[model samples]
Target: MHKLWNRIPPLASDYSGVCSILFELNSLNILYTPSGCVHPIVEVDEIRNFDNVFFYKSNLSDIDVIMGVDDKFLAEAELLVLNNPNLEFISIIGTPVSNITNVDFQKIAEELERKTKIPVIIFNTNGFESYNVGIYEGLLMLAKGLSKEAVRNPKHINVIGYSTIALGYKYHLNELVKVLENIGLKVTFFASDGCIKSITEAAKAAVNFVISPEGVGAAEYFKEKFHIPYFMDIPVGLNGISRVLKLLGTHLNVDLSEIEESIVTRTELRGINEYINKNVLIIGEPLTSIGIRECLRADFVINNITIITNLNSTKKSREIYKEDLFSQVIFVEDEEHVAKYISQADIIIADPLYTIFIRKEDNKIFIPLPHIGLSGREFAKMEYEYVGKMGFEYFKKFLKSEV
Candidate 1:
């Protein structure tokens, strides 16, 4: 018998991913699903605060589903376009119904674009895949659809795979931008956050920074199409931050000596040995989990470290944890397995959703590091203030308060 899922909620679906990529853009987002599917994005996702995003729901009823709703989709899309002259673009996102009915949204999107005289992109995201897959696909389509040929600017860079749902995303990006600017580099565009005009000018950037693993595919596209060099790293903690600065300086041949000196002076303000003997568990997507592990291990001489995630293991991911830093590296699917690890660890650093699996009686210190896939927008307000010296200071404060 299939075990019932009463303890843990389902992970965010491909539909959520499609919506996330389009969240900040000044475009019309239409979800072709039953009315119920809309609740997850509207109620659970972070875009609730973004009033600028134009969203619509095509509530396919049982009869409409059986008869098929191609004409209905065309009619509604045309009407929306007619009504909203200010609309920059339109995205048609599919749910499980599209998969079941075998609807070809790509062809429909082409037709709609022709009919409306407006750019229409379709993401037939069946609920079968996880959020990461959806995010990768959506961003890839966006990059291909929007980025145009232009003269490359050697000092400008684009940050790809950036999502509004990430914890402290704005603050962290601002911090990184300051450092980049200090070295005479500019952030030309944030792939997901900027306007369509900015996205179209993406090829102008001299380099691309793939901040999340979700953005790797998009960065690869930029490299091949525009020949823009890309860097794949999410610089967390002081050491990681230093490495990022040095690597970028070396690549661009910039004088980052002043920034390096500032970083050195800041390091003396905090000691790394304070976390000695503390048992810490890092859990989330592979890229994020690895980042946290590097940061925590660098500053604190923790007695035990455990990294847990459900992301597929690749050669690179395996190489990251090949060292003897983690006592155990767990790739778990079910909540029971995750709960087992939570029970053993003294401190749990994971998405808020995992907290549901933890036993109430256990005095485990829960530090919420929100992941879009796990908790949607529940903790969207929380900033991931864990980058550079400020990030190190944040950890020190957190350790003191919790441990």
Candidate 2:
């Protein structure tokens, strides 16, 4: 009853997040559930489902649940591996049905690996938790299973924890790759950007750029195993990217302040003085909302920024760029509480769906920032830039600061 909401749909579940991560890999993904469970993932959250990845749902019947039948699952997985010799690995994702029935996903994965002789990654993602949790688990598994122990390169860096579900990968990350390359840092791997080699050799990078909370687990794993260091911030806007380069250069004991500034920067402004002293509240995933806040405060026009986020990983992380800079922070658990905060803002920067809490008649301004976790396919098909110099320009549209 506490989780029930009248207008807003539930955010993408853990399995969807796990599936989004697996969607990028060259492996067969088996989501264990009853019938009709995979629709929301393919139809909504996963906008780039090309029907090429071996994605299947284990149609566990009522009797199978009662009997704990796993032989059929093993046989199906073995057959798939036998047929697809090019498969790199396999992913076993769980749903609410498996969670309630006390399914031992580890045992199932062990058996499947023995039968297929290929590595099997398991995400016991019951549908109850949010998608970022599943993504966090999936990426950590990839870090442990696929990334190899290799010699590190000082000029190489990997963009960790970004997923396709964010819906800004094509425009945002592609530009980011070019920017990092131009700065003399080779982007060795970008997680879940559909590069299998990037994932496998992720350890070779001298450092990792952890852009989201989903990458925390994998970043920590690499830090512990391969002794790779990481920073938790995306080079968002023009000023933001320069600050990020400085941060990276500091970590490697190199100076990038001497490097030419980004081509993009804060504009003279079409009209932002009205929002200068306004109380701005940014609602979205942790890293994203924080990046927006960083962008807004770069010129010091909007200092009163509040962040509402879903993941717990960012707050606990060290060396996160200006994590304590926010005026306030709220962990999203209850809808009513979120609405109460939404009503208090002079301006709100969040997905369009969140605007439902605020009436049009109200004087409050709503900045439409699309998050895949909030609206799924509603914004997936649309164009939204949330990375690099162009991303800041896209964000600048709502701020009325485009020059």
Itemize residue pairs with steric clashes in candidate 2: none
**TM-score for candidate 1, residues paired by index:** 0.87
User: Across residues 1-403, which tens digit of lDDT does each residue of candidate 1 receive?
Assistant: 0234466666677678778878778888998876877887788755457565688887568778767878887888888888898888889888888788888788889899989878887777887666666777788888888778989888888878776544334666577778778667877545555578668888888888877766777888988998888877777777667778777777677767677778645444333444556678878766666667777766654547788875434343343335453325676656676777888887888877777767778877787777766677667667556667777676666676233
Worst 10 residues of 2 by lDDT: 312-321
> How many residue pairs of model 1 clash at the backbone?
3
- TM-scores for every predicted model: 0.87, 0.90
Each candidate's clash count: 3, 0
Clashes of 2: 0
